[model samples]
Target: MWNPHAYLAFADERGRPYFDLLSRVGADAPRRVADLGCGPGNLTATLAQRWPQARIEALDSSPEMVLAARDRGIDANVGDVGDWVPKPDTDVVISNATLHWVPDHPRLLIRWAEQLPARSWIAMQVPGNFDAPSHRTVGELARRDRWAERLRDFRFRESPVKGPLEYADLLADAGCAVDAWETTYVHVLTGEDPVLNWIAGTALRPVRSRLTRAEWEEFRTELIPLLDTAYPRRKDGMTFFPFRRIFVVAQVN
Candidate 1:
């Protein structure tokens, strides 16, 4: 179970990229919009502000997230994107900092594209930091140490962000107008192990979910040396973590 409280730690760092992705949406007067994997609905609420004329639906698979969203008076529901059936009326579908959790995301993209009406937009952003020092170090620890056997069933860390041309081609093949790009965000963090702290908020959820408290602690402990080596502490006690993410915006024809 992923804890929303734990994930909220890096809200500032993650929120910037989300806003950048949303800016790409550029919805002038979208009628109906849906936010996929809208955890806690903090970012989803912005869609309502951006397109005040649109009725927004916030969908997330986690009960906790759905409940939080509902408490905020947003039209929130618990539903898996894998099983979600987008309405034909959905004019804009915005998914930020999500999608990576779903396996077979390319298929989902095609399906969402097909579900929307002509000129309907789909804007999404996903972290592509699997190759970053933080992720690579943690992955090495998860696969190389004594706990490796226990974590064998866990999926290895994969880039949440797909290649630009790959995404463009997928949308084009699905008969949609596609614009896709990749960017590396230089996130400056204070204190020690900020990169590790950031991943613990986002990418670490999957690995942590499968392990016991003791095992999780052990894994983090073992991974520390690797993190420090990869992200050497600076004289100012801060670190600059370069995180890459994929952003895509498509309009169905």
Candidate 2:
């Protein structure tokens, strides 16, 4: 039950990394482009604009998100990234802010590298801020006695995302020319409980899905103050949140 509107709440901030990753792709006139985890198709529309001749296809596991993408005139389908296989003509594959959710994405990258056509491009970005205060606070609360048993199987703190070097090495070993980097963007956000509102779109989805409506509300009530404390509003009514992300762009052999 993904909420497309909630996910797009901070679209500007969330879309920056995707643009940064795309700039490094260096794909010219790709015949086919695929956007894995293309939420709401807003950013995926940019891909079409960049290469109008290329066929743009997108996939997301959430039906709601896929519906939203289709409503935006994107060729989107409900599918999981882990099971997706690139077609022979696919020249560009972009997975932005999505791989963190796939635990075995390293293997998938290597497989894609092997399967893609020669000179094809694969670009991806994942959040590297799982250890930051926003996530740490959630993990601490989920581990408490009151919530521990229910959240025992959920992963709140640990991130499946690898470091930049790790991804570079893996892709390089798979016969790709890899460019990997990390960026920490300090976003100045305004409004009450802005941090909470931000996570509600992403990091908090699993927690919310696992808890009852009343339980989710209670958890949110407890989380609001902690997030506020961690990301306090300054005199100008702004909250400075430093988010870290890892980017990798590989040209497959």
Candidate 3:
């Protein structure tokens, strides 16, 4: 139940890392490009613009997201990234801000690297802010006595994403030339409870999906103050959110 509109709330801020990752791809004219977990396809459309002659295909696990992507005239389908296999001629594989959601994504990366044609490119970006105050607050709140039992099985506290070096090493070991780096973007956001709104589109989805409507409302109510305190609005009425993300671009040998 991914809210495409909510996910696109800070499209400009969310898009920067993808463009940065793409800039390092160095693929001038790929024959085919696959955007795994391609969200609403707005960014996937850019791949088409960059290589108009190439076939741009996208896949997202969320049907809601795929529908929104299809609205943009993208060849977007509903499929899980873990189940996706690159075509033999697949020239570029882009997994922007999506790998962290897939368990054991390191293996997936290695498999893609092994399966792609020689000299093919794989570009991926994942959030690296699991230890940040925003996520810390969410973990803290989820552990409180009032909600602890209900969310006992919730694993949002544990980060599945690895560091840049780890990805670089893994891909390098898989016979790919890897370029990996990290960036912390300070995004100045406005509007009410912007951080909550931001995570509602992503990190909060699991909680929301598991809880009833009333319980979800109650949970959000409890979370609002915590997020507000963690990311207090400045005198200028803007909240500054520092988001860290890791990027890896590998050229398969």
lDDT digits (tens) for residues 1-253 of candidate 2 = 8899998989999999999999988888999999999999999999988899999989999999999999999989999899999999999999999988887999999999999999999999999999999999999999999899989877866778899999999999999999999999999899889999999999999999899999999999999999999999999999999999999999998
For residue 82, model 1's alpha carbon misses the true position, in angstroms, by: 0.9
Identify the superior model by TM-score, candidate 1 or candidate 3: 3
lDDT of 1: 0.81
lDDT of 1 by residue, 37-69 (tens): 898877787877788988898899889888877
Q: What is the RMSD of candidate 1?
A: 1.6
Cα lDDT for residue 186, candidate 1: 83
lDDT of each structure? 0.81, 0.94, 0.93
| Candidate 1: segments with Cα more than 4 A from true spot | 157-161
TM-score of 1: 0.94
Model 2 TM-score? Answer: 0.99
| Candidate 1 residue-wise lDDT at 193 | 64
- What digit string (tens of lDDT, one per residue) describes model 3 on residues 1-253? 9899999998999999999999999888899999999999889999988999998889999999999999999989999899999987799999999999899999999999989999999999999999999889988988999888888887788888999999999999999999999999999999999999999999888778878899899999999999999999999999999999999999998
| Cα lDDT for residue 212, candidate 1 | 89
**TM agreement with the true structure for every prediction:** 0.94, 0.99, 0.98
Among these predictions, the greatest lDDT belongs to 2
Task: lDDT for model 2, please.
Answer: 0.94
